[model samples]
Target: MPLATSLAIFQSCKIIGVPKSTRCAILRDMAKVRKAERRPPLNKTHKLKRQDWAKKYLKTDFSKVLWTDEMRVSLDGPDGWARGWIGKGQGAPVRLRRQQDGGGVLVWAGIIKDELVGPFQVEDGVELNSQSYCQFLEDTFFKQWYRKKSASFQKNMIFMQDNAPTHASKYSTAWLARKGIKEEKLMTWPPCSPDLNPIENLWSIIKCEIYKEGKQYTSLNSVWEAVVANVGFKKLVETLDKRYDFPSRNHFSRVCLPALYDECRQGVLKDLANVKYFATTTDLWSSQTMEPNMSLTVHFIDADFNMETRCLQTSYFPEDHTGQNIAAGLRQAIAAWNLDEGKLICMTTDNARNVTLAAQLNGWMRLQCFGHRLHLAIGKLDMIYGCNY
Candidate 1:
């Protein structure tokens, strides 16, 4: 939440060492104030459910929880984004971007691997009831999709679904029970949170890949074909493998991250501009695909004699990572930072032949990076101790 205005904050509070304009600019630029519109608020029970969903199940594998969601596949257009600047209570003209009963197809699907489960389409003009949903599970799911699984496979699996009226109804529960699915076995889902559901993103990815191949869709069959062919399921899984969560892009993307990055970068540069001398280190590596890359960093002692380090660049190495090419990239990055060579100390990199040659070519005093040397020393020690053991 933001205060009414910067002036109000300044007037009501003590003026510390911070500047008025700086604080006001931060509020206006970084602090986005969204009006809490009328929406269903979560109760304590829902909060606890969300908390439970967050906790790791030690005895259970994640594959047991079959994440699923529903999506509307529309041919009319990709959902468009709208943004604006406005004052309080000021009205603006708007036009309806979506049609109620035309030009969209409702589909349900699940994803746990590169393979997609059935993208079953809900019939037109048919409001899905508990019986129909259960029928879908028995027919499309059991017969067409998952019936091929081994008994052990199905035995280990636990179904997850949103707490829609149909999902929780007697008909649905009875169907699940007949299939030996326990009621308490279902994974808890927090309401009003699409971010928690990764299957939703899988749908978007398929859609985007479909359109990227061809903008015009003659039939919904072509759309499904694109979904089946082009979507990179493994890549999407690999992306989310390490990270827990990202902040809402709509909030942070517009200004917050970029602004913070720029501020820190400028601060580093300002410090470097004053430092009399500094050293740089380089590292080079290749991807699994054999694409070469280089990473460079600068280190220095600031005015207070505090050891400071900052990564200058990490990007593709040109053509090949030969001595000449590496030197070209190294010089370019250093020049971009406007680092002076006159008062420079030395350049540090692993004792790679090409890298050392590149340093010598540039007339730079080359030193072995202490970090790389220590890493090599540790590797040698491990090898020696392992043989004895």
Candidate 2:
């Protein structure tokens, strides 16, 4: 019989003021009562098998492979529990609210071998779907690691990533295959296991450096600046493998030594071509003075050759309505650099009527800004009458 039912019967019988010897007889009988069904024994063996496998996997080449993953950093306070003491009698202490001075921005980034790829802006409401994943893989990740001449340093290397839905999708898998990335080359770490990746250690180091400078940030720009300035590639690499120390007398000494040796081998070979020069892109914004302003920046590379970026000259609508004024700034910059108009490549800009007309007149190729294209796509979706594509 269940313990609760037996205890209830005992209590009811006691209320009747039964004799002590009779009550003792009932209690003794209740002690021998048992349930009709039996349960399976606890599976200690299965747990032990899993642990053994984990230990073996940790000692293999899987651990030597560099793992990469993305994390989002918010300008707002962290999610989940607040740390502090609670009084003995207090009815669930109130969470201390942290005041945030500025709004937040979404940062999308991937890391491998103590190297970070980006903290690219993923504007609010933009979903991180397969398409975005592909874009990031092609436009940012592969571009930064393989396309540039400087990144020639990464030849014949393997990259390890998680089995995220997008990463495992058919399209992404095919893309990787086309790019000469091998599935077998990728090290498969156990699912739901983050403790093994050293990048997590790097993140802690990044946060420490950010706070060490004693700077307070209130805006998204300030937060981005602080994060960028603090977490460079060198600092991330310095913290890797710092937690492990193997004794020479250990049975597993040789097994662990190979992983450490591999790291040293890669560290000694540096790519002197400088990858930083090709990873930047240019952006041009309008000024309040009704005059166009242009800034040159690097974006990405292709086939180890740096792909130059060109921003369209901003067009201003004045009472004069003359093309000469708009073209003057661009012409001056080109002449100063001694560049010929025939050598000009792709031009990216907003779909201003004047700018389109100007590009057509100059015989230069123009691509509408991708941000503008996304905005237009969203607008079109809202106006889809019925089955229009």
Candidate 3:
């Protein structure tokens, strides 16, 4: 309270012997003891949220975060204070700057542990409201970062943005919900805490470099040039890798699907070569196009005594499924696979009379498929249960 108000209150109470001067001194001492008020300090909730995030993802690969943010660059020059030293008599340099507003342009960007992408300049006079920002991300991140890498690389990745008003707005959250990103995945940020965000520091370094060496930013095009020119991508990648221990692109490729595919292919070929004989099962089924499709699948035991199955063929079987026609089709498929008729142990199909007759004509031991028999058995059981009940 003010000294005059304190005095008036004290005098009105009429219970104190202390005079106005004494009251003034007391108020002065209290003011001296009190701390200065600061604006918009971090609260306990934000602190606890940050602590929880750290605990949950302390060892997380930061490389997966597709870090995105908007930066405003003033055409006039960089904002904020700058200091320097001078000789006793020489006048110091005066760079009077204002906060970014009208003359500046808003730019969007996406970054990761392995890459520092974009100075993706936003259009002039455009505001990235909730819907607009989501569209921007869909355009940039999906088309650029995601398409550049394999799906395996994106398994651990997520889109990260600060909790700006638009980013946490209803439209943006709804869009993210539609994409199956829930809770912390989208709103995983605390208020006014830029130090926790590495992109903020990245932007700081970029801004400093753009205005260094007495450079002048005259237009949006020049500002874009300065931003892109100053970013030493080679060094940036190296620094991020060194700091976060991220893998190089080549090393990353080695651990992805292509390598797994090659290994699986080799293993399968080696197993097939060792098997002396195999039985095959064939079936004619209607495809999504409502046309008849025939599939031939093989079954055999490996050298390890483990049973394995592999598909040999799936083709458009001829419409004529008569005994002679089906026999010819089965013979052609068996011959195409280089299986000796003498070594062919057996063949199985549904209990269709024409298929059985075809097998007998082809001179292969014919058997009914156990799966088709079991399906028929289940239908009989349903009738038996209905009659008994």
Candidate 4:
């Protein structure tokens, strides 16, 4: 029984609670007993075995080996996020939401000696069936990587890939045989494994490099631009050059396994500044206000003053319908991106009080749209002349 229960019974016996002498006696007796249990320790052990299989496989010479894989490129926002704080008060810790915009992506790739062959964007709705995979091999990967090599290299080349259903299917195997690709040349991939492929590392490096630049894309055009700008053939070749000599048998355990684990840790510490930064013209559209939808565009100029339109964002007017409210929305968007107030050099918009006021607040030199200006100019000339011309 609990000491509190015993104390309660003792107190019930008396009108003014238990006597001091009785309370002291109960406390003294309780102090003599002990409670609580200890738990036993757990033991764990891990062992690794490096195989000689890769050396035996390479005994036939590396000229016979070709590596292949696929990579997915998103047409919308890439599946990633920026780490930041959120919530309020004690015990209300911030959470990291994995940012992803629902959009289609393409996947196709291959590898050769210290070289990456194809990151060909797959056509939309094309499933990764045996026929599609074979088409990529014959048309894209072969034309891009194999045909360019010496005839001797082609005769001896062996393609390697994972046991993806498409790669292992009977139709794909038959296609390879018809193309003079030997079965022995296909590297035997272990089940449930990704560590054996170095292309995995290449993909990670590309994503990390892309994110490091602070770039975001909501449309397919922007996504393609970002992907093209980041992963050129030259960079892929360079990556392969550095890591190709790594042991094949222990490829996953030795290189990819450790690299992948490290990438996870790096991801936790990565930030928005890691994404590539670009400037572009942005047009804002909204229907809920009196102020006509405002459109403002900003351009980024390098040190050489070579200008390119980059960052684009939309601003909507709220119920206030005043110039102040419109200006406030634009300011909030600018502040969210952490752009320098003084560096914003230009603004282009239709002639409107809210638009002009917003530009003035930001100290930007305003340029009226020439097309709109031309229309107004032509209208005034016709009115003054009083002619149908």
lDDT on C-alpha atoms for all candidate structures:
0.71, 0.53, 0.71, 0.59
lDDT of 2 by residue, 84-104 (tens): 456788766444344542345
Off by over 4 Å in 4: 1-64, 75-80, 84-100, 213-215, 231-389
lDDT of 1 by residue, 1-389 (tens): 15366656665676556677787776776675565565546788877767777774545676667777777765543643223466789975353444532265667887654445666777765677898888878778778867798888787777778878788787888788888776556665677556677787787776665555225444555454444445363356446453423234455667777798789889878877887888998889887678878988999998888999989877887577689988888888888788987666899889899999889888899888788888888888889886431
State the local distance difference test value for candidate 1.
0.71
Q: In terms of TM-score, which candidate is strongest?
A: 3
Reference-based TM-score of each model: 0.44, 0.42, 0.47, 0.43
Clashes of each: 0, 4, 0, 19
Better of 2 and 4 by TM-score: 4
lDDT at 188 for candidate 3? 72
Q: Candidate 3 regions off by >4 Å?
A: 1-40, 87-102, 180-187, 231-234, 237-389
Residue 59 deviation, candidate 1, in Å? 4.1
Better of 1 and 4 by lDDT: 1
